[model samples]
Target: MASNNTASALEKEQIFGLAEKEMEYRVELFNKLTHTCFNKCIEKKYKESELNMSENSCIDRCVSKYWQVTNLVGQLLGTNRPPV
Candidate 1:
């Protein structure tokens, strides 16, 4: 029916809007985490230091682990669920 189609279309739009908002929020969080983690994992005084292999490796692993933690926490908070 035309009314059913209209309702479905509206629902899809609402879902899409929510998804967009969630994506924006995730991008913001990622940017913040990258900035904070970079400060914590790297030394300002060693800016001129060529990529110390060990430091680079540590930073890479820390970022990966932090991302995993963020995802787990986000899942626990039901971030993927629709708002009431």
Candidate 2:
């Protein structure tokens, strides 16, 4: 029926909107994580063109902790549902 079709289309639109929002949220999360971790782990004094071993280890720990906190917060907020 036309009404059913309309309802389905509306649902599809809503799903698409949610997906878009999710993508935006993920991008923002990534940007913030990048900035925060880089600032926290990487030294301002650029002694080398590439990361040294200590910097690399610091970055690894920073990223792991960031994800852990993110996941914990997501779980607390009940928004950590497996993606559809």
Candidate 3:
């Protein structure tokens, strides 16, 4: 009984660890994707001029639009309930 309890606790800890690692990985991936997409969408002629008012505005719009699309797709997928 003691051994069984220990094994169950170990399994739970392992699952929790796996979930934490997965969340970290997802955060990293999101950061990378955001950075790459922002860079590609907003071209910079020079370092100093990269984020002038117009450029900042454009970047903001692009980011907003991207999030909107992502949310829409997520909703669609959630409703469809695709096999996991």
Candidate 4:
């Protein structure tokens, strides 16, 4: 039926809209995290243009801890269920 089709189309559109928004939010969060962690963990500048071992370790830990906290906050907020 035309009415059913319309309803279905609207539902799909809403789902896609939410997905788009979520993707945008994730990208923004990743950018923020990258900038914040990089600034916090990498203080030295070198001509080699490569992260030293300590810097690499600090960055890894920083990103991991950031996501851990993010996930915890998300859980507390009861926003979108945590991934399986």
Q: lDDT: which candidate is best?
A: 2
Model 2 lowest lDDT segment of ten: 75-84
Q: Please, what is the TM-score per model?
A: 0.64, 0.83, 0.58, 0.83
Error of 1 at 36 (Å): 2.2
Assess each prediction's global lDDT (C-alpha) against the native. Answer: 0.77, 0.86, 0.70, 0.84
Estimate the lDDT of model 1.
Answer: 0.77
**Per-residue lDDT over 1-83 for candidate 3, one digit per residue giving the tens place of the 0 to 100 score:** 99999999999999999999778866875786578567866665576744677677866787676666666776788843211
Give the Å error, residue 78, model 4.
2.6
Model 4 agreement with the true structure over 9-84: per-residue lDDT tens digits: 9999999999998888878888888998989998756646788888899999999988888888879889763321
How well is each residue in 1-84 modelled by candidate 2, as lDDT tens digits? 999999999999999999999898888888888999899988988999999999999999998988888888778778863222
What is the TM-score ranking, best to worst?
4, 2, 1, 3
Which ten-residue region of model 1 has the weakest summed lDDT? 75-84
Whole-model alpha-carbon lDDT for candidate 3: 0.70
Off by over 4 Å in 1: 71-84
- Superposed model 4: Cα runs more than 4 Å off: 81-84
